[model samples]
Target: MFQKILIANRGEIALRVLRACKELGIQTVVVHSTADADAMHVRLADESVCIGPPPSRDSYLNIHQIVAACEITGADAVHPGYGFLSENAKFADILAAHNITFIGPSGDHIRIMGDKIEAKRTAKRLGIPVVPGSDGAVTEEKEAKRIASEIGYPVIIKASAGGGGRGMKVAHTEADLEVALQTARSEAGAAFGDDAVYIEKYLQKPRHIEVQVFGDGFGRGVHFGERDCSLQRRHQKVWEEANSPALNAEERSRIGSICATAIADLGYSGAGTIEFLYENGEFYFIEMNTRLQVEHPVTEAITGIDLVHEQIRVASGGGLSVKQEDIKFNGHAIECRINAEDPRTFTPSPGTITHFHTPGGLGIRVDSGVYSGYRIPPYYDSLIGKLIVHGRNRVECMMRLRRALDEFVVDGIKTTLPLFRDLVGNADIANGDYDIHWLEKYLAKEE
Candidate 1:
């Protein structure tokens, strides 16, 4: 076991990791930017290091500073809690070169899964279902047209190295393909410094479902279950729940087993998520997140697994503590991303939190890092916290969430609480009759 672990991130996730380390009796060193000197994670860490100034490029994303902090703190391992450099293959390699364990997958795995094109190919090679589209990057216009035609009209062009809905465009017909292709390439080049783009058959209405997988670096792995993250805005997940309202027990077992078997065969280590688009009872692989996901709490809520603790254990060569059959899925869980933003406009809200009060009760959990006087830094993400709830069934879970939302309060700044309150009351959301495009359409209808 590692005596001390350095957290190379910020906000609620940093605090989330810190709490996990504390539970395992591991001392923690939290690295923060100047803008987060007073952040909750820093305040609660056993030791804290100021990495650099506010800008992410100079601070949270600085490799040298993070390595230096580890050296200074004598930490033997580093846990990057999603975002920033969590999925960066070079970062993982650097840590390995320094003989410091990275509490995640190996660099090779990260490199392979980080690339969207390579990930799809890998998924197909592993017998995982994939969408019909181009074999690789569609560089030439002629080739793009050929693939789009073969896949039929209504295709989506996506950046090879893109995320957050950037560098993506849809063409409903052959006439729209040229503009869509050119626009996607331009956006890809500007956003990722890579002009590479790929094409896929765009599903009209698909639910975003992802399987949570964990491996021990050996020929053993298990899946906690799946999270239905169809409630999204601009490709950002707004609400997520476990054992998707769309899937049944048999369907869940089939997909979960497939993911677990693949990870076991690949000898993947630590935490990872295999994301897919589900429509008409079929799942098509979209991408793979080689690090912990933002919506992991819902999985944890149902499985009763301490994923962070497992990550540290596997990284330390302890292997998995539970076998595949030993893991149990108990109940339904839901997570609402509580961002500090305008409820209706979705604009960023960063400022002092005058009064902060979190809901508390059975089956309700709020993971946040802010206090009443905490000044949310404008330089970082606007996510202030997450509210996760669990219940014996989906209906009970929804009811509990509604009651909890009514009790959640944060003053002196705008929040998306109102949005969630409204969503909970909506018929579509209540019945779980939504898809990837449902939220966008609902928002448009409201306008």
Candidate 2:
């Protein structure tokens, strides 16, 4: 087992990894920017290193500096908790070269799935259902239209390396395809430095479902279950739930088995998620997150599996602890991302948290990295914490989430608390009538 691990990210996830390491008897070294020197993860870790200034490019995203921190701490492995360099293939290679274990999948797996287009092809090869779209990247305008024509109208153009809802555009007709192609290409180049773009049949009102998976590098793993992350805004997930209200026993089991098969075929390791877009009882592959997902809490809530602990065990060369039949699903779970932003406009709000209080009761869990006097840095993502609740079923989960939201409080800084307060009382949301576009449209109508 790894004696010490360097957590290579910031905010709540960094703290999340630290706590998991503590339980496993592994010491942790947290890397942070100047703005996060006083962050919760740094405060609790056995060792902390100041990598650079507040800017991510110079700090969290600086590969060499983080690698240097790991070396200085004599860390045997590195745990990238979700963002920053979690899915970065180059980062994984660098760690491997330094004889340090990267607590995720192999670099080859990351490289193959990092490119969204290649992942689609891989999924198809593994007998996973993928959306009908271009066979490869559509480079020219002529080729773009040809694929779009074949796929049907309202096709979506996406960057082969895109994520977080960027580098994607929808074209309802041929005329719109021309403009969308150029814009998507430009956005793709700017965001991922890859102008490569692909096409997919855009589904109207599809539910975003993803399965939580773990592998031991020997083609052995199990799918804990699936999470419903359809509650999104601007391509970002805001609310998530496990044991989606959409799928029943048979449907759930089928999807879970298929996902586990795909992961094993790829020989991937550690924790990952296979995301899909479900419409009319059919699931079309969207993408696979080669690292832990932001909404992983909901899955953990229902399955009682410590995904991070599982990740560590695999990275330590230990085989999977649970087999296919060993896994079992439990009650429903829900998670709400509490970002330090404007509740209505969703503008970034970063400043000193004058007062803070987390809700506590049966089935309530708050994963946070800030304290009452903590100053939220403006240089990174606005997400400050998460509010998760589980119950006997979805109905009770929603009821508990509403009650928890009422008790939760954060002062001296704007948060998405008010927005969640509104959502908790929303009847459509309560009944699980919302889709991927529901939140955006709901916000638009309110505006």
Candidate 3:
């Protein structure tokens, strides 16, 4: 086991890793930007290092500074919680070169899965079902048109190296394909420094489902089931739940096995997620997230597994302690991303939080990085906390979430509490009839 680990991230996820380290008797060193010097994670860590200024290029995303911090702190391993450099293959290689373990998949695995086009090909080769689309990058407009025609109308043009919906466009017709292709290529180049784009059949009103897989570097891998992340906006997940109501027992088993086999074939290590788009009773692979997801707490609540601890144990050359049959989902769990933004306009509201109150009692868990009087800087993501709740069943989980959201209060900055309050109360969500476009349409109607 590692005596100490450095967390190369920020916000609630950073605190999440810290708490996990404390439970395992591992010392934690948190790296923060100058703007987050007094953040909750910094104060809670055994040691804290200031990397750089507020801008992510000079701070959180600065690989050199984070590696230096790990060296200076003598951390045996580094845990990247979700964003920033979590999926950067070069960063993982740098840590390995320094003899510091990276608590995630191998650099080669990341490099292969980080590129959407390459990942899709790998998945197909592994016999995993993938969305019908271009087999490789579409460099020319004619190729894009050809691929789009074969895949049918309503195809999505996505950047080969993109995530977070940054370099994506949907085309419904041949005339629209040209503009969509050009725009997608330009956006991909600007966002990821890659002008390559690929086409995929777009599933309208699809449900966003992802399977969480963990592997111990020694040829064994297992999945903890799937999370329904259909509740999203602008392709960013807002609410997530485990034991998706849409998936039946057979579907769960099939997808779980597919995800496990795919990662195992890739020689993947550590924690990763295989995301899929489900529509009309069919599931198609979308992409793979090569790190711990932001909404991983929901899976933890249901499985009672400490994923962070598992990541550390795997990095330390330990095999999976639990088997597939041993893995069990005790209940339904839901996680709401509580961001420092307005529910109506969806604009970030960054400032000092005058009053902060979190919900408690049975089934309520809050992962937060800001306390009362903490100033939220404008230079980063607006997420302030995560509110996770568990219950014996989905119905009970929804009710508990409604109550928890009502109980949460943070003054002096706008939050998405009201949005969740309205969402949970909606009949469609209560009936589990909502899809990816449900929230967007609901919000549009509200206008």
Candidate 4:
């Protein structure tokens, strides 16, 4: 086991990792930007270092500074709590070269899965179902048009190295393909510094379901069911739930087993999510997140597994603690990503939190890194917390979620709490009748 681990990110996830490390008797070092001088994670961490200024490029994303922090603290491992350098293959390699362990998959695995195009090829080779689209990246306009036409119009152009809805454009017909391709390529080049793009047959209405899989890097793996993240806005998931209301028991088991088997074969280590688009009794592979997902709490809530604890264990060369059969699904769980933003306009709301309150009681958990009088720095993501609720069933879960949302309060700044309150009361959300496009349309109508 590592004597000390450096948390390489900030906000709620850093706090989450810190608590897990404490449980395992591991000392922690948290590095923060100047903007986060008073951040909760820094305040609670065993040791803290100021990396740089507010800008992410100068602070959180600075590899040299992070390495220096590790060297200075004598930390043995780094647990990048998603975002920033979490998926950076070069970062992993650098850590290994310095005799520091990265608490995730190997650098080679991160490189292979980080690229969207290669991930699709790998998924298909592993017998995972994929959407019908181009065999590889289409460089020329002619080739792009040919693939789009062959895929039967309504194709989506995506960056080979992109995520979070960036560098993605959808074309409903051939006439729209040209503009979409150019725009997508331009956005791709600007965001990822790679103009390479691929095409996929766009689904009209598909549920965003992802299977959570963990491996021990030694030919052993297990799955903890799936999470339905269909409620999204601008390709960002707003609400997520475990045991997708859309899937039956058989379908869930089939997908879970497939993902687990594939990870076991690949000898992947730590936590990863195989995301898919589900439509009409079919699952199509989209991408795989090589790091812990933002919505991982819902899966943990259902499986009763401390994922962070497991991540640390596996990264330390310990085999998986639980076998496949040892895993058992409990009830329904839902997570609401409470961002510091305007619920209606979707604008960033970064300011001092005057009054803060979190809901309590059974089946309710709030993972946050802020308190009253904490200043939400504008340089980072606006997500202030996650509100998770679990119950014996979906109906009860929704009821509890509604009550929890009502009790969650953060003053002196706007938040998406109002949006969640509206969603919980909606008939479509209540009955679980929603898809990837549901939230966008709902927001449009409300506007």
The top-ranked prediction according to lDDT is 4
In candidate 3, which residue ranges exceed 4 Å CA deviation? none
Model 4 has an lDDT value of: 0.95
Better of 1 and 3 by lDDT: 1
Model 4 misplaced regions, further than 4 Å = none
Per-residue CA lDDT of model 1 for 110-130, tens digit only, reads 988878999999999887889
Steric collisions counted per model: 0, 0, 0, 0
What TM-score goes with each of the models?
Answer: 0.99, 0.99, 0.98, 0.99
The sequence of per-residue lDDT tens digits that candidate 2 reaches over residues 102-203 is 999989999888888889999999988999999889988898888888878999999998987778999999999889999999999999899899999999
Instruction: Work out how many backbone clashes candidate 1 has.
Output: 0
Tens digits of per-residue lDDT, candidate 4, 325-360, equal 999999999999999999999999999999999999
Runs in model 1 lying further than 4 Å from the true structure: none
Q: Candidate 3's residue-wise lDDT over 78-195, tens digit each? A: 9998889999999999999999998998899998898888899888998778999988999898988888888899999999999788889999999999999999999999998998
lDDT of each: 0.94, 0.92, 0.91, 0.95
